[model samples]
Target: MTFTLGPKATSAGYKLAAFDQIGSTNAEAMVRARDGESGPTWFATTEQTAGRGRRQRAWVAPRGNLASSILEVMDVSPAVAATLGFAAGLSLESALQKLSIEANMRRAGTEPLQFALKWPNDVLAERQKLAGILLEAEAVAGNRLAVVVGIGTNVVAAPEGTPTPATSLAALGVQVGAEELFKALAEAWVEFRGIWDNGRGFGEIRKLWLERAFGVGERVAIQTGTTKVEGTFDTIDDTGCLIVRTADGRRMPITAGEVYFGTAASVGAA
Candidate 1:
């Protein structure tokens, strides 16, 4: 099936550039922005190679997976622009829920899949990593910040022996296609992006995100560079930092790190 923007996205003047195969949707979007394409445009593909995740880790989407990125050029600070990734996570989680419910209805006794947003940029299905999000931004010529939020999902295949155990929708019996998920994602993005409203409505977004957050109130460990911090997952701060309540009653706001939970938290696996 071909990828197309949902009606809401098209009506809102958002454009889509779908690809059967691409090196990286995020890279393509940034290149377009640098070439004077100021947009709320989506660059999507079913197969992605040479993709980079957070911390410059290689992220390759096999032929049946989905890799998509949305580019937005705005006059906002990098800090403010970073919060858009939360909205991106919410959008994908909403889309996955919609598709899972539909898939369950067609089956005899299947339960709906549970999806949650991992801190910073990931979507987890039943606590297993199902998708990853990467946010990249650069300053453009007109003093505008071109931000690309890339989301890659495992629709049919999941890599083995990852830091966090990964799972695909097919493995979970959701039975969704890349094209179908992309359409639902485009529609969900319109709603969340409207609520984000160029970062002015981050307060509402933060509240909504916490409601569907994963690992909150759980024992957590984060590794940043050579240092490791162990604490209870408290909440996310106003600026979207992971707020870990460490020992001694201190709420530490971690800006960036690799996260671990449960037994993995103590072992420092990632």
Candidate 2:
């Protein structure tokens, strides 16, 4: 099938490269960045046979889902990369709201799912898995730097047999087309970049993320490669670690890991 660009995507400042299938959009973008591709470019694909998640787990892209990678060479420090993930998460939540699913669907229960932002990267809807963001960096030829930010939205179907519950916009009964969704996402990123570029700070970004955060201050469990810790869901640290308050009242900081909440917790893959 031929790939199509969003109606709002202009070819003037941005290049939209599409593929029918690829191993992974993020991987491809990283390769291109290493080869010196510069500034505000996007790589999207219909299907990713070998997609990847935070820990290199397989990220299956069934047909109709949105898989794209963004390349940028911002003059920001690497510390700022973490906040960009939250910024992207906020942007995705905005797009989902634009789709106008039921309020309950967006949040989940009484303390509904809040469309919270999972640390580093991952957007959660109703406490179930909804979307993920991956960031990779490479040093340029002239001591410059570039970052490839991969974003995957389950516009249709999700992978099966996963530990964390998976969900999609279609499954949630939202019928917005992928083209429209992509437009909203890209626009959101552009706006987010402006805030990030200025010294607007991560405090404001963290506040937005926490407002919709799922299980914040609630009991939670996190597994980071063989170590599992149960604690109260605290706020995300300045550097983007999800701070978890342990049983002994000590806050254990987590940089990257799988997190879940409740007895039937909906975990998100980092």
Candidate 3:
């Protein structure tokens, strides 16, 4: 399982440890990061046996697709830590562009295939899902940090039991190799980290992210714990909270929840 990228095959200061099979690349990277393994290290597997998504949902990854996780050391606060999800989305958008997926920031007042960011993570190609991200953080020695960001993108095949209409890069007529996509994502993350480090924080990334946002200003639904809120999508704050404007005109900041959007009649709620 060799992972190489482009013509020059530039390594992004991260060691790639590819597995023919593993339970989860994130889980494996977590183990390595906690045991004094210096990161940013990447773990990619051809077949992930027990891949998990947000909320413990099973991520069905076949052998030929991209299943990878990256572990890095950071000194940011928890608030900044939360914004890594958007950073992941932006980085994936870069990788998608490299793969020729037509994943770009749509202009204002333009209606393309609305590929948006759902809350913290998850890139949507139209209303259907195209990619997912999961960020896990652990305390290291003396205020230092280790965070493993897992990314699962459908390059060749999508699982059957997904509730929404899902698509793959190949399905969208973009045939990309797994190794090439991984390298592109690593390079993209390098640029994303720069945005976070320059103290402009996620503001720049948020602006670019919003341009690609699909359901902003539309009627949407969200579920947090036992509470379900229906409201109009508003803006994203610096820390990546989805601001929902209720019917009564109150702006609610949602920290964590499942989000959905559609027409007023068929607004899908997960």
lDDT of model 3, residue 143: 81
Global Cα lDDT for candidate 2: 0.73
TM-score of 1: 0.98
RMSD of 2: 4.3
Q: What is the Cα root-mean-square deviation between model 1 and the actual structure?
A: 1.0
Q: Rank order by TM-score, top first?
A: 1, 3, 2
Native-referenced Cα lDDT, model 1? 0.94
lDDT of every predicted structure (CA atoms): 0.94, 0.73, 0.76
Worst 10 residues of 1 by lDDT: 261-270
Q: What's the TM-score of every candidate structure?
A: 0.98, 0.85, 0.88
Q: Write the per-residue lDDT of candidate 3 for residues 1-270, one digit (tens) a residue.
A: 378543322444666788888999999998887788877777887578899999999986898788888788777665667677788888887777655633323224433344566666787775668888998888887686778889998888877656566888766666567777887887887788677663357788888888877788888788778878888989887778889999999998898877767653244564
Q: State which candidate has the highest lDDT.
A: 1
Candidate 3, poorest ten consecutive residues by summed lDDT: 103-112
Q: List clashing residue pairs in candidate 1.
A: none
- Among the numbered candidates, top TM-score falls to 1
